[model samples]
Target: MDKILLNGMAFYGYHGLFEEEKKLGQRFSVDAELKFSLKKPGKSDDMNDSIDYGDAYELVKEVMEGKPVNLLEALAETISERLFQSYSILEACRIRITKPDPPIPGHYRSVAAEIFRERNE
Candidate 1:
């Protein structure tokens, strides 16, 4: 299958377990891989035959910037659900939600959650 990749999409959101995190908010990065057959688009060179990545970015923006979820898992789930609902040709997807910084007493690059979902599921 062919794939459409969206990467390094950043947003500021108030989503965390701690009150400070919820109040101050932080930066988030999302990387998504949308899997589907691109044969039609590849051959016809028609926009209609392919998924619009701009629209996909908007959907991710809505979820990442809309509600305040306490867990990255929840955000990933919501994104997966929305993608499936929005694209009929999408066969599977992988979503990764990354927090560049958190209110934790540690030295690390970042924390992230990744999920893979198929249309049948």
Candidate 2:
């Protein structure tokens, strides 16, 4: 399968396990790999035959910055669902979300979650 990759998308979101995290929000970085056939677009070079990633980025931003979810897992799941719902041509998707500073008192760069989903054939 071919891919359209959206990487290092940053957002400030109120998604976490703690009330403080939810109220104050934090910096979240996201990466998405959309799996689909590029055959038509590759052949015809038509916008109609391909998924516009700029639109995809906006979709991600909406989900990430919208409602507050308890976990990154849920956030990823929501994004995957929304992607498939909005774009019929999306065959599958992989989403990775990273929290730059989690609740735990650890000296780490970030905590993250990844999820992959495929359209039912």
Model 2, 8-53: lDDT tens digits are 9999999888999889999999999999999989999999998898
Q: Estimate each model's TM-score.
A: 0.97, 0.95
Off by over 4 Å in 1: none
Backbone clashes in model 1:
0
- Cα RMSD for predicted model 2: 1.1
lDDT of 2 at 39: 93
Estimate every model's Cα lDDT from 0 to 1.
Answer: 0.95, 0.93
**What's every prediction's RMSD, in angstroms?**
0.7, 1.1
TM-score of 2: 0.95
Name the regions of candidate 2 deviating beyond 4 angstroms: none
Q: What tens-digit string does per-residue lDDT give for candidate 1 at 1-121?
A: 6899999999999999999888999999999999999899999999888889899999999999998999999999999999999999999999999998667999869999999999997
- Cα error, residue 66 of model 2, in Å, equals 0.4
Model 1 residue 94 CA deviation in Å: 0.1
> How many clashes in each candidate?
0, 0
